[model samples]
Target: MRALSVYRDTTGSKLVLDDVPEPDLADGDLLVEALALGVCGTDREIVARGPIWGTERPDRLILGHESLGRVLEAPNGAEISPGDLVVGIVRRPDPVPCGYCAVGQFDLCENGQYTERGILGRDGFGSERFRLEQDYAVRVDPALGLAGVLLEPASVVAKAWEQLDHVVRRTRRRALVLGAGPIGLLAALLGVQRGLEVHVVDQVEHGAKPRQTRDLGAVYHSFMEDLSGTFDAVVECSGVLVGEAIARTAPGGAACLVGIGAPHGAGTVNLGELNLDLVTQNKLVMGTINSNRSHFEAAHQALRQIDRRWLEGLLTDRLPLSAWRSAFDTSPERIKAVIEFDA
Candidate 1:
């Protein structure tokens, strides 16, 4: 089977599509045929900077975390059978098993020993075939088809919303999503689904991002300053606008930061005013990263309820594995790019 592998060391790093042996299935593991793999900033970063928390010789580290696959084989009595569309959960609990990981909340692993597929210490589903632990594979709605590729990213958004729900007791009427990338667009979609008036701000005034935001019946803006009035819920998906997003949240509202920005040196922030606003208004700001199994399941349900056409619009490019290099293009017009294994 052919797989995308990343090799990195003090010398340098490189990405190669090598012919690797098929993965062996362990007890409680499901053999999955890669259907499609989603490409995001994380994948691009790994290819550029090599592995961070990965193996000493990450040459074997397949570079995909967002995956969509079809079951080729399943262990006895597995909840999913052959031909069922599924996505593999990315994070696994550490050997020591932190208190959170012990309860299946590896997304919140406190000991920093958790292994993330394609990111930390494990191989991922970037190959033509991969083995996924049955417990970590969540079945996708057959109706979603190719849109199932969006599930992993959607899971992160689902977890963020879940966290926001726990903090904000009052009704959330309006939301501001600070970025129009896949994550930002999905965040807007969920906000719209929740009946909140959603507004998305991105640098681009035209193109798929703006159109998609409008398609969801949410307002789109080129600049955050153009959005008048504070929102009851704010999601900062653009790492550059954390301060601005929090500053625009209404009294008693909450802001969730999900984007990981480049470390281009710190910017100035007025602690006195920011602290006063938070203390006087009783506002909250939280950061969320990976998601648990429950979030993936919730993401599936969310996708099932969404308009299929709208979901499809989020996928701007689809390329075959042979053209995988093009799939990683960071073009402005590109939304969600996918590597179609079946193509």
Candidate 2:
């Protein structure tokens, strides 16, 4: 099996595609062949900061989590079968399960001891082949084709919108999505599907990001300064704009922070004033990360409702496994980039 891996030591290399042994599967486990793998900001961060959460393995660590695969082997009575398209959920419950983990909400593990595949303690699905327990694998619509790799990231936004649905009680709302990356754009797409007027903010003015935002029947803005009026809901997918996004929320709005990035160095927020605004305005600002199986199921259905051509347009770059080095480079026009294994 050929897999892309990063070394355990601290050298800033992108990734190394190595020929490794195929993993042995358990009797009840399902074998899946990699079809497509989505590479995101977190993958780049792991390469830049080696030996982080993903270095739990002894030697090199597998380097993909957002993946799409086809089942090759399934235990008897497994919900999925051979040739079915699937995506493996990322997180696993801790040894001593938390309250949330006990109920299959490992995404909300109270003790923060959960293991995330490809990102934390477990080996990821970055190779030509991998094994997953059937329970953790969710079937994706076969019609999605190569675009199915996006289900993991889309699941995150789907969970965010589900949370926002519970928080806000108003109708005909307006939503502001910060950062026009995969997560942000998907968040906007979901908001539009929910009948809200969606507005997307990103630094890129004239590229595919802005164009796709408009394609979804949403407004696009390159800068926050030009944004008019307030939004009933705000989703902060650009971690750098958390403070700014929250400040722009309406009096009764809800803000969901979905992106994971460190704060820009050397600045302090006015905690006192910010607290006052949140309390006095009846606002809700929350952070959401991983998703559960149900969220993945929801994302699968949601992705199907979207225009297939538009969904395909989000996939701007596709590289073969041999061109692994170039896959990690960030580009202005790229909404989503993937490495195609079964192409």
Candidate 3:
């Protein structure tokens, strides 16, 4: 089995694709056969901006974290098994958090669980047979196909809902998802799934972007108007500053920041007026770093029912792993991109 990794030398240079050896599974780990893997905004950043390579011990690394696939083996009586379709999370939680494993918040284990078993950096799932923790492998119905396979990516959005209660410790359910990118859309859609009237906002033209939000019952907004402190909670996955800066967070409302985009140089929280007001107000503002096993499981469970036609539309283009250079170099409006493996 072979895999594609993004490499940056010790001197810090642009990323290059490398075909490397497939990873071997450790105890409590499972081997998965890759099917359809989506290129994430994070992956784009690692390639174009190089934030991820900088996180790893070395800059050189594999570059995919969003993926759906089938399981090939499961040790003992683990919940996963061969032939079971699955959606996998890229980040792992640190086990040393006071009680992450005890409380099931392993994803947030403070010591280091979430970023420890990264799928693409040193243990990524971009290869034909990638090994990952069994706990991270949530089962998906095989019937879902490529679209249903998105359970993991969709789960990335599900993690925000877990925090909704945490954000609004005591408040109503009105919610806002800023940015409308895949995660933003998923966040907005998940809010709607839980009966919250969600407002999806972004400055970008709808363009050829997949309109899945409509199906999930979220009303799209262009952010051309003032929000006027309307939402009880806001999850920021748009990766832009203004969304955080201009967000109309109600008093006591909780805000979740989930995007990767940042201002150049000493990136400040360019929250416009909201930044100054948030301090005096009793609002709960937090930065959620990554998703955990429960998030991965919950996300996969909900995504199993997703409409493939709609999900596939999320894909803006399909590039072979070998064509990665052209995929990013061309830099077209790639809404969703997948690197299909050759049989």
Highest lDDT: which candidate? Answer: 1
Q: For candidate 2, lDDT tens digit of each residue in 205-288?
A: 897898899999999999999799889999999888888877889998899989877756213579898899999999999999
RMSD to true structure for each model, in Å: 1.5, 1.8, 3.7
Clashes of each: 0, 0, 13
Q: Judge candidate 3 against the unseen true structure and give its global Cα lDDT, from 0 to 1.
A: 0.64
* Position 14, candidate 3: lDDT: 60
Model 3 segments beyond 4 Å from truth?
A: 10-17, 27-29, 49-60, 76-78, 93-98, 101-104, 112-121, 169-173, 226-229, 242-247, 264-276, 279-281, 326-333
Scanning candidate 1 in windows of ten residues, the lowest lDDT window is 51-60
Instruction: Rank by lDDT, highest first.
Output: 1, 2, 3
TM-scores of all candidate predictions against the true structure: 0.96, 0.96, 0.81
Candidate 1: regions farther than 4 A off: 9-11, 53-58, 264-266
Candidate 2's error at 233, in angstroms? 0.5
Between prediction 2 and prediction 3, which has the larger TM-score? 2
**Residue-by-residue lDDT tens digits, candidate 3, 1-343:** 5665655645544655566675654523787888766776666666665544435447556556766777777777877878887766655544454576557666566565345333433556667767767666767766666665456567667777787765577747688888666677667767876778887776655654325566667767666374545678788876664345334677778777777665652155546555567766767777776667777777766665556666666666777766765545423234566777642
Which of candidates 1 and 2 reaches a greater TM-score? 1
**1 or 3, which is superior by TM-score?**
1
